[model samples]
Target: MEERLPGADRLPVGRRPSEGLRLPAPDRALSSRTGYTRGTWLAVADHLLDSLGPWFTPSGAQVRLPGRGSWSGADCDGLEGYARSFLLAAFRIAATEGDDRLVERYTRGLIAGAAGEWPRLTPCSQQMVEAAAIAVGLHESRAWLWDRLDGPDQQKVVDWLSGFVGSKTWDNNWRLFQVVGEQFLASVGAPYSQDDIDSGLDRIEDWYVGDGWYTDGDGQNFDHYIGWAMHLYPGLWTRMAGTAADERLTVYGDRLRRFLEDAVHLVGADGAPVHQGRSLCYRMAAAAPYWMGMLLDASPLTPGQTRRLCSGMLRHFVDHGVPDERGLLSLGWHHHFLPVTQSYSGPGSPYWASKGFLGLLLPAEHPVWTDREEALPIDEDDQVRAMPAPGFLLQGTRHDGIVRLLNHGSDHAAPGEGEPPADHHYDRLAYSSRTGPELTADRIDNHVALVGPDGTSQRGRIRRIAVDGRRAASWWKVGASRIEVASVVLGRVEVRCVLVDGPGGVTIRHGGYAIADQQRPEATTAGTWAQTVRTDRLTSVVVGLHGYDEAGVRLGLDTNAFGPHSATPYLVRREHPGGPVLLVSAVVLSGDTVWPEALAEAIEVEVDGLRCVIRMAGGPEEAEEVVMDGGGTPAAAGETS
Candidate 1:
C-alpha cells in the first residue's frame, strides 16, 4: 500500500549527469517491445527538477524569484503545493528510471525543506491539492531515505500534511489536497483516520460538476485549476490507492477524459491550447491531460499523440518563455508582471505539469507506440465546435487544424474589474486568437466584479451544474452589451453576440468596411426568434459596438484585426456629447454564406424607446456609447430620435 510515483520523479536538482538516468521499459501500452530511451525522460525531468525549477529554502519554504524581489515565504497554505511539484517529479522519476538515489535526494530535500517543528504543527494554509501530491509522492516512494529518517521527522511530514484534513478553511482546493494526501498516506501505513478520509471525500462531492468538472470554490469554476489540481489529484490518488469505493475519483477521471476529448480538438496541429485563467503562471499545466491519458486505460488520445502533444506543449512554453531571466519560472508571460497570484503560484507550481508523467504510466506496447503521430484534428481541417466553458459559447475551428478561436461571451469583468481581476485584458469585447501561446489573458479591461461562473447571479456566484444534473446558474457579473469574436478560419469568418440590455438596445453595425448592399439582419434579439439576417462571403468584416462606460457612454467597433481569416477587428467610436445623431453600421455573418451590412441612417433622438431598430443599410452606427436608455431597459425610453 503506497502512493504511486511515475518513472521520472527521482533525481537531484541543479546538475545533470553526463549520461541521463536509466528508466525502465514502460508497460507495452506506452511503447513497443524495445524500451524507449530512458534518458530522454531523465533529461526532460532533470531540466524540470533542477534548481532551475522552483527554489525551496531553509529559512522559509519560499518560492524564490531568481533576480528581483525578496525570497517570499509561502503562506503556510501555499507551502505544500510548492513542494508537491518537486516531490511528484522526484517520485515519478524514481518510478520510471529505478533511480533510488534520485528519490532519496528529494525525500531528504522534503524533510530538510520542512525543517523545524513549524510544518508538523501547521498544515499548509491553502489546503490545496499541490501539497497533497507531494505527500502522496513520498508515501508511495517509501523512498530510500524514509526508513532512515527519525520517527519524529517522518511524523512531522505526516502530521503537517494530515492536519489539513480537518481544518475549517478546508475550503475547496484545501479539502481536495487533503483527500489525495490522506488517501496516499493511509495507503502507505500513515494513520489518517478513515473517518477523516471519508469526510474529506464527502466534502469534495459537494463541488462536483458533471462532465468531469469540479469547481474548486463556489461559482463558475472554469480553468486549468480543474485539470491540474482538482480532478487531477482525485483521479491519480484513487488509481494509486486502487480505491474502488471512491466513485467520485473514478468519475473524475472519466469526466476529465470527456473534457480532454471535447477539448483536445481545439488545440491546433501545433498543440497550442487556449489559455484562460490564473497561474497560467504554471504554463504547461494545460498539457497535464497527456499524463491522465496514460493513467486511465479508457483514454481517447493516442500515445504518440500524447507524446507529441506533451512534448510540443513543453517546447512551446520553454521556447516561448517559461523561466524568466533568473532561471526561475517568471510571474508573467513574455515578462514579469502578475501581482495577483495566490502565494501558491510561485515558481514551483508549473512543474505540476509533471502530471505529464501520467503519459509514462503506459505499458510499452501501446498503439501510442506503434501508431505514427497523426496531425492533431484541429490542424487537419475546417470545422466549427461549440463548448460551454468559463461562461459563454466557445466556438473553435481550424484549417487543417490550424487554430481559430471565437469568444462569444461578455468581457464585463476583466482585470481591474475586481480586486485581483484577471491577468489578461483587452478593451473592446476582447476575444483572443491563438497560434502559439495562451491568448485569452491578453484581454484585461472589463471594469466589474469578475467572480466565478455563478458570480453574476443573485446567488452571488457563477452558476454551475453537477453530474447528477442538479442545476445551478449564478449570473456571474457580465459586461452589458457584451460581444465576442467567435471563429476566423481561412477565408470564412463568424462572430457571435449575446446582448443584454444596454443603451438604445445595444446597436451594432458596420460603416467604413461595409460591402455593397446584400441581405442584412434587421435586428438581433434574446428571444428565440433569429432576427432577419443574411451573410455574404467577404475577405474582411467590420463589426462595430457602441455601449456606455461608467463615464457617460463610449462608442467602439470590433474591427481592428481586419481580415476574413484573422482575429476579428473591432474598434470603438470615440464620442463627445453634442451633435445630431448620425449613422451607425454593423457586420454580420448571416446563416447563409452570403453577408451584407445593415445600416441605421436615422439621426433623431427618441427619448423613451427601449428598442431601437437597426434598419438595413445606412442605419446609425450602433453606438457603444453608454447612455442610460429607458429605465435601464435598453429597449424603448431613451433611443436617440
Candidate 2:
C-alpha cells in the first residue's frame, strides 16, 4: 500500500490536533462485500482515539480533573488502559498516515505511569486489579511504550508485573482477566511468572463447561465477560509468552473456536450482547472475542460477519449517542442507564475498545480478510445449540430484531430458602432474558448476579432442587441459551415461556399466585417495592417485595400497591410450594403503541395444577404458549463506548 503524509512515521502526542474531529459519520454505510473492510477497523480505532483524546491530560493518566466530571468508583480505574490504548491505535493508524507522534506519546506516558506507581502498588492491591492495569504497561509493544521507557522505568514495570505471579489466587472473572492480560504480556516476552501463568490457566481449565463457555469465578451467572475477556486474552498471552505456551494456548484456541461459534449468536441484528453480570463498564468490549476470531482464526465467522458485528456495535452505541461532548466517553444508555459503570472504570478504561483492534495483527492477505460475508448465528431468525457437557441447551430467537431468553432448566428458589436481600441495582428477572449476565449490581463475594445478605451480589449458589418428589439440577439461561449449574436444594418451580413474533411485541403469562402461600399480611401493604414496565393496555408489573422474613413476623417486609395491585410482576416465583407471599402475580406483554387486537383477543389464562398457562387469543391452532414469570423491563441497560 502507498503511504501518505510526512509525520505518519510516529505519533506526536501533545494533544489532539483538531477538536470534534468527526468522520463522515457512519450512517448505514454498508459495504457491498465484506465483514470489516481493510481499513474499516483502523477507521474505528482512529475515531476512538480522536474521540477520547480530550479525556487524557498531556501527562496521560486519566483523572478527568474538575470541569470534565469528577472521576469516581470503577470509572476511575478505566483511565489507565484507555490512555495506553491510544498508542496501539496510533501504531495501526501511523503506518498509513506517516505521522506517529500519538504512538510515542502514549508509550511514554505508560512508562511514566509505571514509574510513578512502582513504589506504591501495595502488597495488598487486588491481584486482578493491579494485574490488569500494570500488565498493559508491560507488553503492548505497538507504539513502543517499553522502548521509550528509561531502563529503570522498564525494570519497575516488568518487576512489578512479575511480582504478581503469586500475589492472589485468581478465580472466575478475576482469574480470567488476569490470566489473559498476563498471557498477553508474557506472549510479548514481558515479565510474568510461569507459575502465575500456569496456576491461572489451571484454575480456568476447571471451569470450562463444554460447548464453548467458562464460568465467571466458579459460580453460576457467568456471561459476556467470558466471551470478551476469558476467550480472547489467552491468545495474546500465548502469542507473547513464547512458543512454549503454544500447546496450551492452542488447546484454548481450539475450544474458543467452538465457543465463538456458539457465542457469535449472542449478538443480535443490532450487535447488542445480552448484558448480564458485573463490570459492565467494559460495554462494547464484549465484542472482543471476534478480535480473537481474527487472532486464533476461529471459524464459522467470516470477515463480513466480523466487520458487520463490529460495525453494528459501533452503530448501536453511536445511534444511542456515545462519545460525550469533549470527545471523551461517558456512561449511560437512554440516559438513565449511565450508572452501568463501576468506580474501577476511570476514563482510560474505555480503550479496552481496542479489543476491536483484533484485526490489526492480521495482515491484509489472510483468509479472515478475504472471506466473504455469511449470516452469523445471531443473524439467524431462530438458532439453537445443545451442550451435553454442561447439560443445558442454548436457544436464540429474534422479535423486533431483539434477542431474548427463556430459561426452563434453572431454579431461583431453594427449599426453605428465604428471599435474597434487597440491592439497588440487581434486577432479579433480567438475567432470564438478557443475552448475557448483567454485572455492576454491587455483588457479594464478587459474584455477578447473586443478591447476598448485605444486599450485594455474592458468590453463586447452585444445587439440585427437588420438584414433584424428584431431584433436579439447574442451569443459567441468558436469553434462549441455558447453562447447566451445580446441584441445588430447590423446590418445584414450573416456568413456561411463549415467544410473540411482532414489531415490539411481547409474551405474557400468569403466575400461580392463587396458591395457599400468597396470603399477604394486611399491615405490610404500604411499604412494598415495585418496578414497572409499560407494554400496552397490559403494563408488565412487579410487586409484593419481601426483603427478609424472620419466623412469622418478617424482618424486612417492604410493601407497595402502586403497579398492578391485583397482579404483581417483580418476583418470578410468585407462588411456591410452601411460601406465603406472591410477588410476581401476572406477566403479559401488551402493546406499547399499537396493540394488535389479536394480541388482546389472543390472551387467555388457564389453570393446570401448579402450572398456569397463558394462551394467546389467536386461533388455538396458530397461537403460541407464553411463560409469564413476573418481572418487566429486562435491564441489560448498557452499551459499548
lDDT of 2 by residue, 1-641 (tens): 32222122221222222234243423233443222355555654565566655545566644342222324334334344443464345446433533355656555555655556323333334434535644543354434444556677667656656545556644555664456555655654666666766787788887786667776554333556677667766766665566777688668778888887766755656666554445554556777788777767665577777767765665454433344434444443311133455544554555555555555666667655555555666465545444333233344444333343222222222223332233222322322222222222332110112222334223222221221111122322322222221111111111222111111111122221110011231111222222222221322222211221110111111121111112222222211223111111222221132222333233454443222344433224432332222222132212110
In candidate 2, stretches whose alpha carbon ends up further than 4 angstroms from where it belongs are 1-21, 24-40, 51-54, 61-99, 117-119, 123-153, 176-192, 334-338, 365-372, 378-380, 384-399, 407-427, 430-597, 600-606, 611-641
Position 103, candidate 2: lDDT: 57
TM-score of each: 0.63, 0.65
- For each candidate in turn, give its C-alpha RMSD to the true structure in angstroms: 12.1, 12.2
Best-performing candidate as measured by TM-score: 2
* Lowest lDDT 10-residue stretch of candidate 2: 485-494
List model 1 lDDT by residue over 1-641, tens digit each. 21112212221123222232223433334433222333344445664555433455543343443433313343433454356455646545545544664555565556655654234434444434445666656654554555557887787676666665554444665665666667766765777666666776677677676655566665444556777767566666676567554665566667777777655754444445554455655666666665675666546777666666665565444434343324345555423444424444554455455665555445445555445454555445544554444433333344323333332222323222231243332112223223111123222112121223333211112221111111111112234322112122212332221223223322222111111111221323221111222132322233332232211111122211111112222223233222212222233322233332322122222222222332222323452122222223222122111
How does residue 354 of candidate 1 score in lDDT?
A: 62
